[model samples]
Target: MDVRLARKYTVKLSFEEIRLPPFEDILILGKKCPQGRIGVFRSFDFLVPNEFESYEVEDKSVEAVFINKRVLKKINNEKIIEILQERVFPYVSESEIIKVDFKMTIFYDFIEGEL
Candidate 1:
């Protein structure tokens, strides 16, 4: 006999904190500056089992996509566990995560006339 698995659902990205700059800045030439330049940076992306819309089905199952080992190292297992406990547990039922997938990317700024 063969068993069929349930379909997986897509969920919105959830994070502990989504920090965005409140204001934009303009740089003046020939002026002393404390910082070189201002830009937006993504600090972290926290994922919890409960947050997934399909948590009911995905629970007790491990699925993940990873980017790079460096990025993975940045997020310690302890921190991930803490985040899951604090943010995911309250919403999801008890379940085991057997797999995880990670994705990583690097971005750069561009200027006119420059490749």
Candidate 2:
């Protein structure tokens, strides 16, 4: 007696408009993320050169954080990290890459003349 087995495979397809850099303002990379810091940094450099700044963290969950340099000009780097620690880091995992659309609003006062 002989026995035969048959296998079938199903494929699903989806389309998305690719966005360069992917993240809008910030990208939080977990410690064990599939793509390491150097690779991500290099890609960003090629895609949007000098546009982002990388910060390697010494935390348990998060490995590094990438912020738009423009954002850095408006906000302190340490303060941004502090905000992430409190609001975002708690929900991230070692194997995840989280994209954050960090938005900021600033209010300023102007003086007509200087004394």
Candidate 3:
């Protein structure tokens, strides 16, 4: 699966807020600031990104810059659930989660063999 940084939200989490029980990968969709690359991180080890802010899709700043951005070539929804909860859903209301799901474009991880 391949997901683009369609729209982002004001949702943000700090290392303090990020819990660690059944730890798993988080679905990060956007450009990593400073270095600048459309990528994803399974774990947040002091990684901050730019673009993709605001669950209200249109409110995000992705499209024009990262349009057709290439992300991880492989993905597992079941795995990123924890990341979404701690980092994503917390900022938005319980009701808005469903709406966020509708707008995203799912992408997958990339490997060197194909290239």
Candidate 4:
């Protein structure tokens, strides 16, 4: 059996006046900072192309909506929180983070059927 694991990190920012753009939109802005790289995924709509063809190439434009999104690597959670607290806290006044979600996906192939 062979298996693979994948993980993705996403952060959602909400403001009182929709001041903060959607994650995808932010990624398109191409904002640069010492923090990280930020990018947005334009279309969430899904469609099946050439459903009858097994090897047909599908052409679609998944526009990079916002390029302002930033990414920080090799940093601990505590440090991230600290940085957010210091830099973001000042700008956001009594703001609320509606949700924080994490997802992990696993792909596996069985050499001889079900394990």
Give the winner by TM-score.
2
How many residue pairs clash in model 1?
Answer: 17
TM-score of each: 0.23, 0.79, 0.22, 0.23
What tens digits encode model 3's per-residue C-alpha lDDT throughout 18-111? Answer: 6431222222232213322222221222343331222212223221112111222243333334445455644543222122321347566974
Instruction: Give the per-residue lDDT digits (tens) of candidate 2, residues 1-115.
Output: 3344565679999998987987779999999999989989999989999999999998999999999998998998999999999999999999999999889998778858778
Residue 85's lDDT in candidate 3: 47
lDDT of 1 by residue, 1-115 (tens): 3345556679899667542222111111111122211211111123221212111112232222112234345455445445544544344322322223333354669756856
Question: Which stretches of model 3 miss by more than 4 angstroms?
Answer: 1-73, 97-115
Error of 4 at 4 (Å): 66
Give candidate 4 misplaced runs (Cα > 4 Å): 1-21, 24-73, 95-115
Each prediction's Cα RMSD?
22.7, 5.4, 20.8, 24.8
Global lDDT of each model? 0.30, 0.92, 0.31, 0.26
Best of the two (1, 4) by lDDT: 1
**Better TM-score candidate (3, 4):** 4
- Give a tens-digit lDDT track for model 4, residues 55-89: 11111211112111122223333443454345443
